[model samples]
Target chain A: MIASLALLAIGLALVVVGPRLAGARWTRQAPWLAILTWQALTVAAVAAVVLAGVTLLIPITAVADDLGAILHACAVSIATAYAAPEFLPGRLLGTVLAGVVPVWLLVCAARVLIGGWRARRALHRSLDLVAEPGADSGGLVVLEAAAPAAFCVPGRTSHIVVSRGALNRLSRRELDGVLAHEAAHLNGRHNLAVALSEILLRAFPRVPLFAVAAVQTRELIELLADDAALEAVDRVSLASAIVSLAEMRAPAAALAMAQGGAALRVTRLLAPEPPMTAWRHRLGAVAALAIVAAPLFLAGYPALSAALSDLCNI
Target chain B: MRPFGELEAAIMKELWSRGEPATVRDVLASLSTSRTLAYTTVMTVMDNLHRKGQLDREMSGRAWLYRPVRSRAEHAAALLQNVLDEAGDRQEVLMHFVADLDSASVAQLRSAVEAARRQGDSAPGDAG
Candidate 1:
């Protein structure tokens, strides 16, 4: 029961404070690390909450030498825990938390995955109808639109699409920069990151951490891709390419962040900064690992201590 | 394996350029100027395109005549519109180079680019 409360507290703390820490401006300097941290925080929070429920339902006394004995103890514990009038509320809550959270997350993930698959298929069909092969050897396709836009559709048959208007507007070097950027996106499999963030946001619409994470993941992946593009093309060319392609009007709801994202990316490109130092990178990695492991540690400590005491008795 | 995508693209381009319905024999003839393809191959591709709703077909004498469902430009425009409109929902499906920005941000970024260019050009020694 104490372990369950501790785990729940840790989960709640992460839900509230993790976003503020991860959303710091310093994260922009290390987008990949930031992405990793965000993923770790999300995973930890979910695990903590689910494990809290599990610990609540199964008492520390349920710990046994064998898996079968442990299962039997857990079944007995759950039945007695539910029957006790004094613990009815906690037991009911535990059952709901453990059973509902994972099921809800899974359902949301499936919905997003199916929807994304259908949308991608439709886009591929449209591309086949309208796109022409580009001069490049890569899976580049040219769309005959007058607006300068470039995007990549990722899948087994991934395509990097550039509008004819973009070809006209961008010089050869600038085009190279844009192509490298899209290539980074495809090669990095950034789509999976975006989809995972979206799933969390959808599952917990009210959680500020997930909302911030969804936005930050989108922005950080772009920065990471820009860094990759910088290796292939000069920063000036990439910056100019971004400026040329920044003319589209985003939806009003996302205007603030979308507006900031392009300007941030362009400025970052124009005035480059060194990446995070080795120590800082290591510190961030350690922190992420600790965050992910803390919940499991809290949930297992009681049983572990009980087993250790029994061994000491022998 | 054969480049089926290239063949489909070539047939669509040929049909769109003609701006009129063409039979498989006619398509094969026009396409043969560049690369030799079997008449049956052309017929199969056109048939596939028609099935995909990219092409409309009508009976002309004993053979089927095929034409693009929409003009090339119209198709391009609609496709672009779909991509932009669906940007909000289907971002995971397509990773755009730059997210759509309002005019104000665009203007801000443009100046930043100019400033960077000036700095880069003024300092010849700088590794930009």
Candidate 2:
């Protein structure tokens, strides 16, 4: 029970503090590390909460060497815990936390994945009709729109799409930069990373951490892609391409939520900063690992100590 | 299998350019100038497109005459509209190069890029 409470407390603290930690200045300089940290924080929080419930259902006294004996002890502990009036409420809460949370998460994940897949397939079908293969644009499907636009549809057969307006507005070098940016997105499989954050946001809309992480993930991904594009094109060209593409008109409602990602990206590109030092990178990786492992260690400590004592007696 | 997609594109292009209902034989003749395709292949592709609702078919004599449900420009406009409408909501479906910025932000960013370019020109060695 004490371990379960400790785990729950850790989860709550992480939910409150994770966003602030991720929003630090260092994230812009090292987006890959930042993305890793964000993923670790989210996974740890979910694991902590779920483990808290499981630890409640299975008391430390239920620890045993064999599977059968362990199961028997867990069954007896749960039955006795429920039978006692004093423990009934805690047990009920545990049942809901352990049983309901995972199932709810799974349902939400399914909805997001299936809905995203259907939407992508439909978009691909539309592309087949209205787009033609570009002549020398590196296999990009050229759409016949006059509005400057560019995007990539990711799937087994991913396509980088650019409109005729973009072609007309951008120089050859600028267009190459844009294509490189979209290629970075597809090569890195950034879609899956974004989807994971989206799932959490959908599952718990009210949680500040999930909400903040979703927005941050989207921004970081654009930065990451820009960084990749730098390898193939000059900063000036890429920055200009970003500026040209920003001419697209969005709805008024979305303008309020827009972070002006283009501005941030262009600034970073123009005055690039040195990446994190080797030692700092190592420190960041270790911190991410610790965040994920802390909950598991907290929930398992009691059982681990009990087993150690049993071995000593033997 | 990849060529099938190209063939579908060719068939659609042929139908749209003809500006009238065309039989499978008519499409095959226009397409044969570029590459030889079996008659059954053209028929099967058109049949699939009709099933997918991209084309409408009517009986002309003994054969089905196929026409695009919408014009090429209309399809292109609808595709662009769909993309812009869903851009804000569906991040997983597509990764746009840059989200559309308001006019104010666009002006700010354009100037920023201009400044960067001026700085780069001063230091020739720094340009990639």
Candidate 3:
């Protein structure tokens, strides 16, 4: 029980502090690794908390001394609260924490998804009316407005939108850079990642990890797309396009070509860094593995042993 | 098959080609030659276009006559311009548009363009 509580404490602490410790600069330096780290933290934190709750029930049923008796005890308590009067409080708390929290999280996730779906439907309906098939061969839709904007709507048939303003304002090279950036987002399926992060953040708002991860993931995906765009566009052109288009806004549901942290993106473009070394890559992998595995082992091992012993004793 | 934006394009084409305000019936007759469509569908499409500020409608007797609000070229430009006038958190929606650029940064970009031009290198070309 003490060990379970300690593991749970560690998990909670990680949930609160992990993102802060990572810091924005760390993530900006190695976004892919940062993504892995954030994902592991979120998963491990949830697993740890749930496992901790379940583990607490282990000692209460330890008298049973085996797995079968532990289940029987749990079922009996749930059926009639008085069945295990001595351990009723722990049983109730464990059941509530382990069962109710997930359901609540699931509900929150559903709400975010439904909202996103509705927003997408509304946007597509309006976009269909306002935009025209672009003259460019890439199957983009050109909006008549003079706002120098470009973005991609993600779906079965994703459409890239480029305003006439952007086409007129940007030189050929600059326009290509902008289009490539938007295309990178579409091809990479960054919308799904952004959506998932959004769902998780809304579902678990209190978990500092989710909030930070959501923001960082959003930022990282843009950087990733920018990197992909660099293959076809020179640094100066991409940077210039990003700056010029910085004033244009994409709809909330869509991933705009040059959204958020424009200055940081521009700076990174001008002074590009070499990819991380193999040793650093290995270190990142190992760190991610450890972060994900720690909570599960700490919380699960004790619960399993206690449940087995309780069943045997019963 | 008419997909997505094509309905609006077709309706706009009819209006633009007629070069005059026409009733829904007139637009429908013109569009029907390409592909048969119901009057209500055409009416609804036109009504939506009007609501979107793409079409202007005026009542003629008991029926409403509609025309393109602007020339095809002007309309396209207006739609793109509207993208800049969106109401929301400016930072949140900031995408390709530059909200802020100091004189120095703009100058730097100009020089970069000059260098690129001198080198005869265009943006390595668009998406493959």
Better-scoring candidate (TM-score), 1 or 2: 2
lDDT of 3 by residue, A117-190 (tens): 65455445556665788878775788877545676666656667877767777778888887788788778777
Best by TM-score: 2
Give each prediction's root-mean-square deviation over alpha carbons.
Answer: 5.5, 4.9, 6.6
lDDT of 2 by residue, B1-128 (tens): 11126677789888988999999999999999989899999999999999988899999899999999978987786687678667767889999898877777777888888888888899899886
A93-121, model 1: which lDDT tens digit per residue?
A: 78877899999999999999898887777
Q: Write the per-residue lDDT of candidate 3 for residues B64-92, one digit (tens) a residue.
A: 99988778666556544544445222212
DockQ scores of the candidates: 0.40, 0.42, 0.23
Error of 2 at A135 (Å): 2.1
- Per candidate, chain B TM-score? 0.65, 0.67, 0.58
Best by lDDT: 2
lDDT of 2 by residue, A202-232 (tens): 9989999998898889999999999999999
Ranking by lDDT: 2, 1, 3
Judge candidate 3 against the unseen true structure and give its global Cα lDDT, from 0 to 1. Answer: 0.67
Q: What shift in Å separates residue B120 of candidate 2 from its native position after superposition? A: 1.4
Quote each prediction's TM-score: 0.82, 0.84, 0.73
Better of 1 and 3 by lDDT: 1
Candidate 1 segments exceeding 4 Å error: A59-86, A248-258, A311-314, B1-19, B22-66
